[model samples]
Target chain A: MATNTEITSRDSSAAERRGAGTAERRGNAGEPPIRPPVDIREDGEGITLCADMPGVSKDRLNLRVDGNTLVIEGTARLELAENEEALYADVRSSVYQRTFALSGELETGKIEATLKDGVLTVRIPKRLELRPRKIEVQAS
Target chain B: MFSIASSASDSLFDELWQLQQQVDELFGSWTSSSGGIRSLPRGSFPAVNIGHTPERVDVYLFAPGLDPKTLDISIQQNLLTVTGTREIPTEEQATYYRQERFSGEFRRVIALPEDIDPDRVHAKYRDGVVQIGVERREAARPRQIEIH
Candidate 1:
Protein backbone atom coordinates (compact mmCIF):
# COMPACT_ATOMS: atom_id res chain seq x y z
CA MET A 1 0.00 0.00 0.00
CA ALA A 2 1.18 3.48 -0.83
CA THR A 3 1.02 5.76 2.19
CA ASN A 4 0.54 9.32 0.96
CA THR A 5 0.97 12.63 2.73
CA GLU A 6 -1.71 15.24 2.36
CA ILE A 7 -0.74 18.68 1.05
CA THR A 8 -2.88 21.74 1.73
CA SER A 9 -0.68 24.62 0.73
CA ARG A 10 -2.55 25.52 -2.43
CA ASP A 11 -4.75 28.63 -2.25
CA SER A 12 -7.71 29.34 -4.53
CA SER A 13 -8.43 32.98 -5.17
CA ALA A 14 -12.07 33.95 -5.62
CA ALA A 15 -13.18 34.50 -9.21
CA GLU A 16 -14.96 37.61 -10.50
CA ARG A 17 -18.43 38.45 -9.19
CA ARG A 18 -20.88 38.20 -12.10
CA GLY A 19 -24.53 38.39 -11.00
CA ALA A 20 -23.71 38.75 -7.32
CA GLY A 21 -25.41 42.12 -6.96
CA THR A 22 -29.05 41.05 -6.59
CA ALA A 23 -31.09 37.87 -6.29
CA GLU A 24 -33.61 38.92 -8.92
CA ARG A 25 -31.10 39.04 -11.75
CA ARG A 26 -31.39 36.29 -14.38
CA GLY A 27 -28.61 36.24 -16.92
CA ASN A 28 -25.64 34.08 -17.84
CA ALA A 29 -23.18 36.83 -18.71
CA GLY A 30 -22.53 38.22 -15.25
CA GLU A 31 -22.48 35.29 -12.84
CA PRO A 32 -19.68 35.25 -10.32
CA PRO A 33 -16.98 32.59 -10.44
CA ILE A 34 -16.58 29.94 -7.74
CA ARG A 35 -13.43 28.32 -6.44
CA PRO A 36 -14.02 24.60 -6.18
CA PRO A 37 -12.69 22.77 -3.14
CA VAL A 38 -9.75 20.40 -3.55
CA ASP A 39 -7.83 17.62 -1.84
CA ILE A 40 -4.20 16.54 -2.41
CA ARG A 41 -2.34 13.44 -1.25
CA GLU A 42 1.23 12.31 -1.78
CA ASP A 43 2.54 8.76 -1.95
CA GLY A 44 5.93 7.18 -2.62
CA GLU A 45 5.37 7.35 -6.39
CA GLY A 46 3.73 10.75 -6.80
CA ILE A 47 1.03 13.18 -5.71
CA THR A 48 -2.67 12.93 -6.44
CA LEU A 49 -5.09 15.89 -6.50
CA CYS A 50 -8.88 15.85 -6.68
CA ALA A 51 -11.20 18.83 -7.20
CA ASP A 52 -14.98 19.14 -7.22
CA MET A 53 -16.20 21.22 -10.17
CA PRO A 54 -19.84 20.58 -11.01
CA GLY A 55 -21.57 21.68 -14.22
CA VAL A 56 -18.24 21.68 -16.02
CA SER A 57 -17.71 19.48 -19.05
CA LYS A 58 -14.46 18.07 -20.38
CA ASP A 59 -14.11 20.60 -23.17
CA ARG A 60 -14.49 23.53 -20.83
CA LEU A 61 -11.68 22.44 -18.51
CA ASN A 62 -8.02 23.44 -18.90
CA LEU A 63 -5.00 22.05 -17.06
CA ARG A 64 -1.47 23.33 -17.46
CA VAL A 65 1.88 23.34 -15.79
CA ASP A 66 3.96 26.51 -16.00
CA GLY A 67 7.49 26.30 -14.67
CA ASN A 68 7.01 24.93 -11.16
CA THR A 69 3.35 25.94 -10.90
CA LEU A 70 0.34 23.82 -11.77
CA VAL A 71 -2.92 25.46 -12.77
CA ILE A 72 -6.45 24.12 -13.15
CA GLU A 73 -9.25 26.17 -14.71
CA GLY A 74 -12.82 25.40 -15.72
CA THR A 75 -15.66 27.49 -17.12
CA ALA A 76 -19.32 26.69 -16.47
CA ARG A 77 -22.15 28.22 -18.45
CA LEU A 78 -25.77 28.26 -17.20
CA GLU A 79 -28.72 29.31 -19.30
CA LEU A 80 -32.34 29.34 -18.12
CA ALA A 81 -35.35 28.85 -20.35
CA GLU A 82 -36.96 32.04 -21.66
CA ASN A 83 -40.01 31.84 -19.38
CA GLU A 84 -38.26 30.36 -16.39
CA GLU A 85 -37.46 32.39 -13.28
CA ALA A 86 -35.31 31.55 -10.31
CA LEU A 87 -37.32 30.90 -7.17
CA TYR A 88 -34.39 29.90 -4.98
CA ALA A 89 -30.78 29.54 -6.01
CA ASP A 90 -27.71 28.50 -4.02
CA VAL A 91 -25.53 27.51 -6.95
CA ARG A 92 -24.31 29.72 -9.81
CA SER A 93 -22.34 29.21 -13.02
CA SER A 94 -18.84 30.58 -12.97
CA VAL A 95 -15.20 29.85 -13.58
CA TYR A 96 -13.08 27.73 -11.25
CA GLN A 97 -9.36 28.39 -10.82
CA ARG A 98 -6.67 26.89 -8.59
CA THR A 99 -2.89 26.93 -8.58
CA PHE A 100 -0.20 24.93 -6.78
CA ALA A 101 3.54 25.50 -6.54
CA LEU A 102 5.44 22.37 -7.39
CA SER A 103 8.58 21.22 -5.63
CA GLY A 104 11.84 20.08 -7.19
CA GLU A 105 11.34 16.47 -6.16
CA LEU A 106 8.51 15.96 -8.65
CA GLU A 107 8.97 14.86 -12.28
CA THR A 108 7.40 17.62 -14.29
CA GLY A 109 7.22 15.64 -17.52
CA LYS A 110 5.17 12.76 -16.14
CA ILE A 111 2.07 14.65 -14.99
CA GLU A 112 -1.32 13.16 -15.85
CA ALA A 113 -4.94 14.28 -15.37
CA THR A 114 -8.49 13.03 -15.85
CA LEU A 115 -12.02 14.44 -15.52
CA LYS A 116 -15.09 12.36 -14.66
CA ASP A 117 -18.48 13.16 -13.16
CA GLY A 118 -17.41 16.77 -12.58
CA VAL A 119 -14.34 15.79 -10.59
CA LEU A 120 -10.76 16.34 -11.79
CA THR A 121 -7.91 14.16 -10.67
CA VAL A 122 -4.25 15.03 -11.27
CA ARG A 123 -1.29 12.75 -10.78
CA ILE A 124 2.24 14.14 -10.42
CA PRO A 125 4.93 11.54 -10.42
CA LYS A 126 8.25 11.88 -8.58
CA ARG A 127 11.59 11.91 -10.38
CA LEU A 128 13.48 8.64 -10.36
CA GLU A 129 16.64 10.28 -8.95
CA LEU A 130 14.69 11.51 -5.94
CA ARG A 131 13.16 8.12 -5.10
CA PRO A 132 14.65 6.19 -2.18
CA ARG A 133 16.93 3.26 -3.04
CA LYS A 134 18.66 0.58 -0.96
CA ILE A 135 22.33 -0.25 -1.51
CA GLU A 136 23.98 -3.59 -0.65
CA VAL A 137 26.90 -3.64 1.77
CA GLN A 138 30.19 -5.26 0.74
CA ALA A 139 32.43 -7.32 3.08
CA SER A 140 36.21 -6.82 3.05
CA MET B 1 12.26 27.43 -10.72
CA PHE B 2 10.42 29.42 -8.06
CA SER B 3 11.42 32.82 -6.87
CA ILE B 4 10.78 34.09 -3.35
CA ALA B 5 8.70 37.23 -3.00
CA SER B 6 7.70 39.40 -0.09
CA SER B 7 6.23 37.16 2.59
CA ALA B 8 4.48 39.99 4.46
CA SER B 9 1.97 40.76 1.72
CA ASP B 10 1.29 37.08 1.21
CA SER B 11 0.31 36.58 4.85
CA LEU B 12 -1.88 39.68 4.75
CA PHE B 13 -3.66 38.46 1.66
CA ASP B 14 -4.28 35.08 3.28
CA GLU B 15 -5.79 36.77 6.36
CA LEU B 16 -8.07 38.89 4.24
CA TRP B 17 -9.19 35.87 2.27
CA GLN B 18 -10.07 33.98 5.42
CA LEU B 19 -12.11 36.92 6.69
CA GLN B 20 -14.00 37.17 3.41
CA GLN B 21 -14.85 33.48 3.53
CA GLN B 22 -16.28 33.90 7.02
CA VAL B 23 -18.47 36.77 5.89
CA ASP B 24 -19.75 34.81 2.91
CA GLU B 25 -20.67 31.90 5.17
CA LEU B 26 -22.54 34.21 7.53
CA PHE B 27 -24.69 35.59 4.73
CA GLY B 28 -25.25 32.22 3.10
CA SER B 29 -26.74 30.82 6.29
CA TRP B 30 -28.85 33.92 6.79
CA THR B 31 -30.65 34.13 3.44
CA SER B 32 -31.34 30.36 3.24
CA SER B 33 -33.22 30.42 6.55
CA SER B 34 -36.50 31.62 5.09
CA GLY B 35 -39.59 29.36 5.08
CA GLY B 36 -39.46 25.93 6.73
CA ILE B 37 -36.43 25.01 4.69
CA ARG B 38 -33.33 24.47 6.79
CA SER B 39 -30.04 26.08 5.92
CA LEU B 40 -27.25 23.72 4.96
CA PRO B 41 -24.33 23.39 7.30
CA ARG B 42 -21.18 25.30 6.45
CA GLY B 43 -19.10 23.65 3.73
CA SER B 44 -21.93 21.30 2.92
CA PHE B 45 -21.26 18.91 0.07
CA PRO B 46 -23.03 19.31 -3.29
CA ALA B 47 -24.52 22.78 -3.33
CA VAL B 48 -27.83 23.24 -5.22
CA ASN B 49 -29.73 25.64 -7.48
CA ILE B 50 -33.54 25.86 -7.70
CA GLY B 51 -35.68 27.56 -10.30
CA HIS B 52 -39.23 27.42 -11.62
CA THR B 53 -41.19 27.99 -14.80
CA PRO B 54 -44.94 28.43 -15.35
CA GLU B 55 -45.21 24.78 -16.28
CA ARG B 56 -42.88 23.24 -13.70
CA VAL B 57 -40.22 23.77 -11.06
CA ASP B 58 -36.62 22.77 -11.60
CA VAL B 59 -34.01 21.82 -9.04
CA TYR B 60 -30.35 21.47 -9.94
CA LEU B 61 -27.99 19.69 -7.58
CA PHE B 62 -24.23 19.98 -8.08
CA ALA B 63 -22.75 16.56 -7.45
CA PRO B 64 -19.72 15.34 -9.33
CA GLY B 65 -18.12 11.91 -9.24
CA LEU B 66 -21.36 10.26 -8.12
CA ASP B 67 -22.77 7.15 -9.75
CA PRO B 68 -26.21 7.73 -11.26
CA LYS B 69 -27.29 4.19 -10.39
CA THR B 70 -26.49 4.77 -6.73
CA LEU B 71 -28.54 7.96 -6.49
CA ASP B 72 -31.95 7.75 -4.77
CA ILE B 73 -34.49 10.49 -5.49
CA SER B 74 -37.97 10.61 -4.00
CA ILE B 75 -40.87 13.04 -3.82
CA GLN B 76 -43.51 12.95 -1.10
CA GLN B 77 -46.30 15.50 -0.69
CA ASN B 78 -44.49 18.84 -1.15
CA LEU B 79 -41.09 17.54 -0.12
CA LEU B 80 -38.33 16.57 -2.54
CA THR B 81 -35.51 14.45 -1.25
CA VAL B 82 -32.22 13.42 -2.84
CA THR B 83 -29.88 10.86 -1.33
CA GLY B 84 -26.59 9.44 -2.56
CA THR B 85 -23.17 8.23 -1.46
CA ARG B 86 -19.63 8.80 -2.75
CA GLU B 87 -16.92 6.36 -1.82
CA ILE B 88 -13.33 7.51 -1.62
CA PRO B 89 -10.41 5.50 -2.94
CA THR B 90 -9.01 3.91 0.18
CA GLU B 91 -6.82 1.22 -1.29
CA GLU B 92 -3.81 3.52 -1.22
CA GLN B 93 -2.33 4.14 2.20
CA ALA B 94 -2.12 7.91 2.54
CA THR B 95 -1.36 10.40 5.28
CA TYR B 96 -3.61 13.41 5.55
CA TYR B 97 -2.08 16.66 4.37
CA ARG B 98 -5.46 18.14 3.49
CA GLN B 99 -8.70 16.30 2.76
CA GLU B 100 -11.51 18.67 1.65
CA ARG B 101 -13.44 16.56 -0.82
CA PHE B 102 -16.61 15.28 0.80
CA SER B 103 -17.45 11.57 0.74
CA GLY B 104 -19.92 9.07 2.22
CA GLU B 105 -23.70 9.37 2.21
CA PHE B 106 -25.64 12.64 2.07
CA ARG B 107 -29.31 13.58 1.85
CA ARG B 108 -30.87 16.92 0.89
CA VAL B 109 -34.56 17.74 1.39
CA ILE B 110 -36.25 20.65 -0.36
CA ALA B 111 -39.74 22.04 0.18
CA LEU B 112 -41.62 22.30 -3.09
CA PRO B 113 -44.06 25.00 -4.08
CA GLU B 114 -47.73 24.46 -3.37
CA ASP B 115 -49.99 22.63 -5.81
CA ILE B 116 -47.24 20.65 -7.49
CA ASP B 117 -48.20 17.64 -9.61
CA PRO B 118 -46.22 14.92 -7.91
CA ASP B 119 -46.97 12.40 -10.65
CA ARG B 120 -45.52 14.65 -13.37
CA VAL B 121 -41.93 14.75 -12.27
CA HIS B 122 -38.79 13.90 -14.20
CA ALA B 123 -35.12 13.80 -13.27
CA LYS B 124 -31.90 13.61 -15.26
CA TYR B 125 -28.28 13.36 -14.22
CA ARG B 126 -25.63 14.69 -16.57
CA ASP B 127 -22.14 16.21 -16.52
CA GLY B 128 -22.07 16.01 -12.73
CA VAL B 129 -25.35 17.92 -12.31
CA VAL B 130 -28.73 16.43 -11.34
CA GLN B 131 -31.78 18.23 -12.72
CA ILE B 132 -35.26 17.46 -11.35
CA GLY B 133 -38.42 18.86 -12.92
CA VAL B 134 -41.82 18.83 -11.23
CA GLU B 135 -44.84 19.96 -13.15
CA ARG B 136 -47.18 22.48 -11.56
CA ARG B 137 -50.86 21.63 -11.01
CA GLU B 138 -53.01 22.86 -13.85
CA ALA B 139 -55.20 24.91 -11.54
CA ALA B 140 -52.21 26.62 -10.00
CA ARG B 141 -50.95 28.06 -13.29
CA PRO B 142 -51.62 31.73 -13.86
CA ARG B 143 -54.17 32.53 -16.54
CA GLN B 144 -54.62 35.83 -18.36
CA ILE B 145 -57.83 37.59 -17.29
CA GLU B 146 -59.76 39.11 -20.21
CA ILE B 147 -61.60 42.43 -19.77
CA HIS B 148 -65.25 42.04 -20.62
Candidate 2:
Protein backbone atom coordinates (compact mmCIF):
# COMPACT_ATOMS: atom_id res chain seq x y z
CA MET A 1 0.00 0.00 0.00
CA ALA A 2 1.25 3.48 -0.96
CA THR A 3 1.10 6.05 1.84
CA ASN A 4 2.97 8.84 -0.01
CA THR A 5 -0.35 10.17 -1.39
CA GLU A 6 0.78 11.90 -4.59
CA ILE A 7 -1.45 11.88 -7.67
CA THR A 8 -1.39 13.46 -11.10
CA SER A 9 -3.45 13.19 -14.30
CA ARG A 10 -2.66 13.54 -17.98
CA ASP A 11 -5.06 14.54 -20.75
CA SER A 12 -4.99 15.28 -24.51
CA SER A 13 -1.91 13.32 -25.37
CA ALA A 14 -0.78 12.08 -28.74
CA ALA A 15 -2.92 8.98 -28.61
CA GLU A 16 -6.47 8.49 -27.42
CA ARG A 17 -6.27 9.17 -23.69
CA ARG A 18 -8.87 7.54 -21.51
CA GLY A 19 -9.29 9.08 -18.08
CA ALA A 20 -7.39 6.08 -16.69
CA GLY A 21 -4.65 6.82 -14.18
CA THR A 22 -1.50 8.17 -15.83
CA ALA A 23 2.03 6.88 -15.20
CA GLU A 24 3.37 8.80 -12.20
CA ARG A 25 5.84 8.07 -9.38
CA ARG A 26 5.53 8.90 -5.70
CA GLY A 27 9.05 10.29 -5.52
CA ASN A 28 12.23 10.60 -7.55
CA ALA A 29 14.30 7.44 -7.49
CA GLY A 30 17.52 7.48 -9.55
CA GLU A 31 16.14 7.24 -13.09
CA PRO A 32 12.38 7.75 -13.21
CA PRO A 33 10.46 4.52 -12.67
CA ILE A 34 9.38 3.02 -15.99
CA ARG A 35 5.89 1.99 -17.01
CA PRO A 36 5.84 -1.79 -17.13
CA PRO A 37 4.05 -3.36 -20.11
CA VAL A 38 0.41 -4.08 -19.29
CA ASP A 39 -2.34 -6.17 -20.83
CA ILE A 40 -5.93 -5.06 -20.34
CA ARG A 41 -8.92 -7.34 -21.08
CA GLU A 42 -12.50 -6.24 -20.87
CA ASP A 43 -15.45 -8.61 -20.67
CA GLY A 44 -19.16 -7.90 -20.12
CA GLU A 45 -18.56 -8.40 -16.42
CA GLY A 46 -15.50 -6.24 -15.80
CA ILE A 47 -11.84 -5.72 -16.74
CA THR A 48 -8.58 -7.54 -15.97
CA LEU A 49 -5.17 -5.87 -15.81
CA CYS A 50 -2.00 -7.88 -16.13
CA ALA A 51 1.37 -6.15 -15.71
CA ASP A 52 4.74 -7.73 -16.51
CA MET A 53 7.09 -6.66 -13.73
CA PRO A 54 10.00 -9.01 -13.36
CA GLY A 55 12.32 -8.81 -10.30
CA VAL A 56 9.48 -7.39 -8.20
CA SER A 57 8.79 -9.55 -5.15
CA LYS A 58 5.60 -9.74 -3.11
CA ASP A 59 7.18 -7.90 -0.18
CA ARG A 60 8.25 -4.98 -2.35
CA LEU A 61 5.02 -4.70 -4.35
CA ASN A 62 2.66 -1.90 -3.33
CA LEU A 63 -0.87 -1.97 -4.74
CA ARG A 64 -3.53 0.45 -3.59
CA VAL A 65 -6.67 2.20 -4.78
CA ASP A 66 -7.46 5.83 -3.92
CA GLY A 67 -10.91 7.06 -4.81
CA ASN A 68 -11.26 6.18 -8.51
CA THR A 69 -7.50 5.87 -9.03
CA LEU A 70 -5.78 2.48 -8.97
CA VAL A 71 -2.06 2.66 -8.35
CA ILE A 72 0.49 -0.11 -8.97
CA GLU A 73 3.90 0.61 -7.50
CA GLY A 74 6.72 -1.84 -6.96
CA THR A 75 10.48 -1.74 -6.58
CA ALA A 76 12.26 -4.42 -8.56
CA ARG A 77 15.17 -5.82 -6.61
CA LEU A 78 18.14 -8.06 -7.44
CA GLU A 79 18.94 -10.15 -4.40
CA LEU A 80 22.61 -10.99 -4.06
CA ALA A 81 24.69 -12.60 -1.36
CA GLU A 82 26.56 -10.31 1.01
CA ASN A 83 29.86 -10.91 -0.77
CA GLU A 84 28.50 -10.56 -4.33
CA GLU A 85 29.00 -7.40 -6.33
CA ALA A 86 27.02 -6.62 -9.47
CA LEU A 87 28.82 -4.78 -12.27
CA TYR A 88 26.20 -4.56 -15.01
CA ALA A 89 22.50 -5.17 -15.57
CA ASP A 90 20.12 -4.36 -18.45
CA VAL A 91 16.78 -3.69 -16.72
CA ARG A 92 17.74 -0.01 -16.47
CA SER A 93 16.07 0.77 -13.12
CA SER A 94 14.61 -1.18 -10.21
CA VAL A 95 11.46 0.95 -9.86
CA TYR A 96 8.12 0.28 -11.57
CA GLN A 97 5.03 2.48 -11.25
CA ARG A 98 1.73 2.73 -13.11
CA THR A 99 -1.79 3.90 -12.32
CA PHE A 100 -5.25 3.34 -13.80
CA ALA A 101 -8.44 5.33 -13.16
CA LEU A 102 -11.46 3.15 -12.58
CA SER A 103 -14.96 3.68 -13.86
CA GLY A 104 -17.88 3.83 -11.42
CA GLU A 105 -19.37 0.68 -12.92
CA LEU A 106 -16.70 -1.51 -11.31
CA GLU A 107 -16.56 -2.61 -7.65
CA THR A 108 -13.45 -1.10 -6.11
CA GLY A 109 -13.72 -2.97 -2.82
CA LYS A 110 -14.02 -6.34 -4.49
CA ILE A 111 -10.84 -6.14 -6.62
CA GLU A 112 -8.95 -9.43 -6.57
CA ALA A 113 -5.23 -9.51 -7.23
CA THR A 114 -2.35 -11.96 -7.29
CA LEU A 115 1.39 -11.73 -7.96
CA LYS A 116 2.94 -14.73 -9.65
CA ASP A 117 6.22 -15.25 -11.48
CA GLY A 118 6.75 -11.48 -11.68
CA VAL A 119 3.36 -10.73 -13.24
CA LEU A 120 0.67 -8.81 -11.37
CA THR A 121 -2.91 -9.72 -12.22
CA VAL A 122 -5.71 -7.56 -10.88
CA ARG A 123 -9.35 -8.32 -11.63
CA ILE A 124 -12.01 -5.68 -11.05
CA PRO A 125 -15.57 -6.92 -11.27
CA LYS A 126 -18.57 -4.88 -12.28
CA ARG A 127 -21.00 -3.57 -9.70
CA LEU A 128 -23.76 -5.99 -8.76
CA GLU A 129 -26.60 -3.64 -9.67
CA LEU A 130 -24.89 -2.66 -12.93
CA ARG A 131 -24.42 -6.28 -14.00
CA PRO A 132 -26.86 -7.80 -16.48
CA ARG A 133 -29.91 -8.99 -14.56
CA LYS A 134 -33.11 -10.83 -15.46
CA ILE A 135 -36.00 -8.33 -15.18
CA GLU A 136 -39.48 -9.80 -14.49
CA VAL A 137 -42.28 -8.13 -16.43
CA GLN A 138 -45.64 -8.05 -14.66
CA ALA A 139 -48.99 -8.18 -16.59
CA SER A 140 -50.65 -4.71 -16.56
CA MET B 1 40.68 -3.99 -23.78
CA PHE B 2 39.91 -0.44 -24.87
CA SER B 3 39.35 0.41 -28.55
CA ILE B 4 40.85 3.53 -30.09
CA ALA B 5 38.02 5.58 -31.58
CA SER B 6 38.64 6.68 -35.19
CA SER B 7 39.17 10.45 -35.40
CA ALA B 8 37.34 10.71 -38.76
CA SER B 9 33.97 12.35 -37.93
CA ASP B 10 32.37 10.83 -41.05
CA SER B 11 33.36 7.25 -40.23
CA LEU B 12 30.45 4.92 -39.47
CA PHE B 13 32.76 2.77 -37.35
CA ASP B 14 33.10 5.59 -34.85
CA GLU B 15 29.34 5.74 -34.42
CA LEU B 16 29.15 2.02 -33.78
CA TRP B 17 31.89 2.26 -31.16
CA GLN B 18 30.02 5.09 -29.46
CA LEU B 19 26.83 3.06 -29.45
CA GLN B 20 28.70 0.12 -27.98
CA GLN B 21 30.05 2.30 -25.18
CA GLN B 22 26.55 3.54 -24.38
CA VAL B 23 25.25 -0.02 -24.29
CA ASP B 24 28.21 -1.10 -22.19
CA GLU B 25 27.39 1.60 -19.67
CA LEU B 26 23.77 0.52 -19.53
CA PHE B 27 24.04 -3.28 -19.76
CA GLY B 28 27.51 -3.63 -18.14
CA SER B 29 28.63 -6.84 -19.86
CA TRP B 30 27.85 -6.60 -23.58
CA THR B 31 30.89 -8.65 -24.52
CA SER B 32 29.51 -9.81 -27.86
CA SER B 33 28.17 -6.94 -29.96
CA SER B 34 27.93 -7.26 -33.74
CA GLY B 35 29.32 -4.10 -35.34
CA GLY B 36 26.83 -4.04 -38.21
CA ILE B 37 24.37 -1.13 -38.06
CA ARG B 38 21.39 -3.21 -37.08
CA SER B 39 18.84 -2.17 -34.47
CA LEU B 40 18.65 -4.58 -31.54
CA PRO B 41 15.08 -5.73 -31.08
CA ARG B 42 13.60 -3.73 -28.22
CA GLY B 43 11.36 -6.64 -27.20
CA SER B 44 14.10 -9.14 -26.35
CA PHE B 45 12.43 -11.29 -23.70
CA PRO B 46 13.98 -11.75 -20.28
CA ALA B 47 16.47 -8.93 -20.29
CA VAL B 48 19.70 -9.85 -18.51
CA ASN B 49 22.46 -8.13 -16.59
CA ILE B 50 26.00 -9.55 -16.42
CA GLY B 51 28.46 -8.77 -13.69
CA HIS B 52 31.47 -10.50 -12.20
CA THR B 53 33.38 -10.82 -8.94
CA PRO B 54 36.96 -11.93 -8.50
CA GLU B 55 35.93 -15.58 -8.22
CA ARG B 56 32.88 -15.92 -10.51
CA VAL B 57 30.91 -14.26 -13.26
CA ASP B 58 27.30 -13.50 -12.26
CA VAL B 59 24.41 -13.26 -14.70
CA TYR B 60 20.87 -12.25 -13.79
CA LEU B 61 17.96 -12.68 -16.18
CA PHE B 62 14.65 -10.90 -15.50
CA ALA B 63 11.71 -12.96 -16.77
CA PRO B 64 8.38 -13.22 -15.00
CA GLY B 65 5.45 -15.62 -15.33
CA LEU B 66 7.57 -18.66 -16.05
CA ASP B 67 7.43 -22.31 -15.12
CA PRO B 68 11.00 -22.53 -13.81
CA LYS B 69 11.46 -26.20 -14.63
CA THR B 70 10.88 -25.58 -18.33
CA LEU B 71 13.73 -23.05 -18.70
CA ASP B 72 16.95 -24.33 -20.28
CA ILE B 73 20.38 -22.86 -19.64
CA SER B 74 23.34 -24.43 -21.37
CA ILE B 75 26.98 -23.65 -22.05
CA GLN B 76 28.65 -24.63 -25.32
CA GLN B 77 32.21 -23.46 -25.93
CA ASN B 78 32.26 -19.85 -24.62
CA LEU B 79 28.61 -19.11 -25.25
CA LEU B 80 25.97 -19.43 -22.53
CA THR B 81 22.56 -19.91 -24.12
CA VAL B 82 19.21 -19.67 -22.36
CA THR B 83 16.05 -20.75 -24.15
CA GLY B 84 12.42 -20.74 -23.02
CA THR B 85 8.84 -20.16 -24.15
CA ARG B 86 6.30 -17.84 -22.55
CA GLU B 87 2.61 -18.51 -22.96
CA ILE B 88 0.29 -15.52 -22.89
CA PRO B 89 -2.09 -15.84 -19.92
CA THR B 90 -5.51 -15.06 -21.27
CA GLU B 91 -8.69 -16.86 -22.20
CA GLU B 92 -9.19 -17.47 -25.92
CA GLN B 93 -12.61 -15.86 -25.77
CA ALA B 94 -11.47 -12.88 -23.70
CA THR B 95 -11.65 -9.49 -25.40
CA TYR B 96 -8.29 -7.72 -25.09
CA TYR B 97 -8.27 -3.97 -25.26
CA ARG B 98 -4.48 -3.71 -24.92
CA GLN B 99 -1.65 -6.24 -25.19
CA GLU B 100 1.78 -4.74 -24.60
CA ARG B 101 3.41 -7.65 -22.82
CA PHE B 102 5.90 -9.71 -24.82
CA SER B 103 4.90 -13.35 -25.21
CA GLY B 104 5.89 -16.47 -27.20
CA GLU B 105 9.42 -17.96 -27.30
CA PHE B 106 12.73 -16.28 -26.52
CA ARG B 107 16.34 -17.37 -26.67
CA ARG B 108 19.07 -15.26 -25.06
CA VAL B 109 22.70 -16.20 -25.64
CA ILE B 110 25.55 -14.60 -23.75
CA ALA B 111 29.22 -14.90 -24.70
CA LEU B 112 31.15 -15.80 -21.59
CA PRO B 113 34.52 -14.19 -21.17
CA GLU B 114 37.55 -16.35 -21.87
CA ASP B 115 38.62 -16.41 -18.22
CA ILE B 116 35.40 -18.03 -17.02
CA ASP B 117 35.58 -21.78 -16.27
CA PRO B 118 32.70 -23.48 -18.06
CA ASP B 119 32.96 -26.57 -15.88
CA ARG B 120 31.99 -24.67 -12.74
CA VAL B 121 28.66 -23.19 -13.71
CA HIS B 122 25.45 -22.91 -11.70
CA ALA B 123 21.92 -21.56 -12.36
CA LYS B 124 18.65 -21.23 -10.49
CA TYR B 125 15.25 -19.60 -10.95
CA ARG B 126 13.47 -17.80 -8.12
CA ASP B 127 10.77 -15.16 -7.88
CA GLY B 128 10.75 -14.55 -11.64
CA VAL B 129 14.55 -14.13 -11.88
CA VAL B 130 17.08 -16.56 -13.31
CA GLN B 131 20.49 -16.25 -11.67
CA ILE B 132 23.68 -17.87 -12.96
CA GLY B 133 27.15 -18.03 -11.51
CA VAL B 134 30.17 -19.19 -13.51
CA GLU B 135 33.44 -19.57 -11.67
CA ARG B 136 36.59 -18.03 -13.07
CA ARG B 137 39.80 -19.94 -13.71
CA GLU B 138 42.35 -19.87 -10.87
CA ALA B 139 44.75 -17.75 -12.93
CA ALA B 140 42.00 -15.19 -13.69
CA ARG B 141 41.49 -14.38 -10.02
CA PRO B 142 43.31 -11.27 -8.87
CA ARG B 143 46.31 -11.97 -6.58
CA GLN B 144 46.62 -9.64 -3.63
CA ILE B 145 50.16 -8.86 -2.41
CA GLU B 146 50.91 -8.73 1.31
CA ILE B 147 52.15 -5.21 2.01
CA HIS B 148 55.63 -5.54 3.59
Score every model by TM-score.
Answer: 0.75, 0.75
Task: Encode model 2's per-residue lDDT on A1-140: one tens digit a residue.
Answer: 21222222322231211111111211123466668899999877889998988877666666778789998877666655445644544555667789999999998878877888788888899997898777899999
* Model 2 spans with C-alpha error above 4 angstroms: A1-29, A81-87, A133-140, B1-40
Any idea what lDDT model 1 has? 0.72
The per-residue C-alpha lDDT of model 2 at residue A64 equals: 76
Question: Tens digits of per-residue lDDT for model 2 on B1-148?
Answer: 1233444543687788888787666444443363112213445677776666778888898888888887989998768889898888677777998898888888887776688888999988766888898999999888998999
Residue-by-residue lDDT tens digits, candidate 1, A1-140? 11122222232321323223222234434445577888888887888888898766665666777778987777654444667766655764466778889999998777877777788888889998887677779997
Candidate 2: clashing pairs of residues: A21-A101, A117-B65
Model 1, residue B142: distance off in Å is 1.7
Per-residue lDDT tens digits for candidate 1, residues B99-148, read 78888999889888888998999988766888899999999999999999
